[model samples]
Target: MSIQRRHTAQQLGDCFKVAAELALPVLGRQSRHLDGLTDIKLVHGIVSGQGKLSGLRFTHAWVEGLDDNGVKYVVDASNGREVALPSDLYYLIGEISPSECVRFTPEQARRHLLDAGHYGPWCGAPFEHEDPVPGVAA
Candidate 1:
């Protein structure tokens, strides 16, 4: 897969929502705690698809739950417990193949977030390039 131009917050968040929705079915059978949305996760991408994979081609998806045992349990929200969300359930939209998924890494996510300040909705938090708020301690 070609290296995708880095994603912005809206772009990456959209992708995360995609992975989250797909996981919902699996999560529905396990925990209701997902309703609370404790936090969202950005995790490592894995290799699956034609051709030898390296770096970017091998992608990652954002998951809602942590890895427990050998499998990743998802947030059910309806039941409030963890259920395994299969890795196979994730696939990028409109990609020629699964491998084309533009993986979102945590570091990339951080950068996207930092960049968001330029156009993000935080009306009070100043951009990093600008003067700091007296006590905000960002």
Candidate 2:
């Protein structure tokens, strides 16, 4: 009998770490405004998979902000991706309180990644696992 091994998507800190670092300068200067609310400080959140990927959750980090016109935008520094914040995994971490900020170190970041079950080398594939459809393979 032969054993088959499947590959998973690649996990790198370039997107997450770099995005946070790059956005910090802008975040310090800008504030996001929501509909009926006053301007509020921007935040760094992890967007777990944005485009069309299978059921796999790949963590792509981005910063959320509002333009002067009150339009919301998500900025990705790794690729300079500016788009409207999707209604998906926008988890905010490193914030102790609404007014307090906690910058995550390399160790802390690794810990969170491990806790999320996303620490390790991946194959850069889209789907985390095969589709459930009958005999459908990715």
Candidate 3:
């Protein structure tokens, strides 16, 4: 058999670079809420970014943990807790192997956020997002 390169889901920054190269404006990454697959993602452009998120500036971030279904989850750095964020609360980073989903329901997992104890804080915070991207947001 011939060797083939695996096509892992691209990272948020990698996606950005791809977007920049291909000129495709919009793209979403797994948010820091689902777990680590691609359920929620980071949607950003090649310009300014969001400074305010849910009364927070998004000063910190971290990958929550993989849900039962394989979905990705992210968390806030400060509290070390998984947030009950909306499904559409996308982030600026892109996903790798995004198709994988969390096995459990969003509500159920959220209830166990504090108990699961898989929370963490990111050192490199999200920067300013670029202008609106294409094929991403309406």
Q: What is the C-alpha lDDT of each candidate?
A: 0.34, 0.34, 0.28
Measured by lDDT, the strongest candidate is 2
Q: Write the per-residue lDDT of candidate 2 for residues 1-138, one digit (tens) a residue.
A: 111223232333344434434344432322232223222222323233434433323434444545566654444445434334422322332111222222343344344434444321112322233212123221
Off by over 4 Å in 2: 1-13, 26-53, 79-138
- Model number with the top TM-score: 2
* Decoy 1 TM-score against native: 0.28
Error of 2 at 19 (Å): 1.3
Comparing 1 with 3 on TM-score, the higher-scoring candidate is 1
Instruction: List TM-scores for all candidates, in order.
Output: 0.28, 0.35, 0.23
Q: In candidate 2, which residue pairs get closer than 3 Å at backbone N, Cα or C atoms, i.e. clash?
A: 8-123, 9-124, 10-124
Query: Global CA lDDT of candidate 2, please?
Result: 0.34
- Clashing residue pairs in all predictions, respectively, total 12, 3, 36
What's model 1's overall lDDT? 0.34
What is the C-alpha lDDT profile of model 3 across 52-134, one tens digit per residue?
22222221222233466664444332222224432334343322122322222334323322243311111122333222233
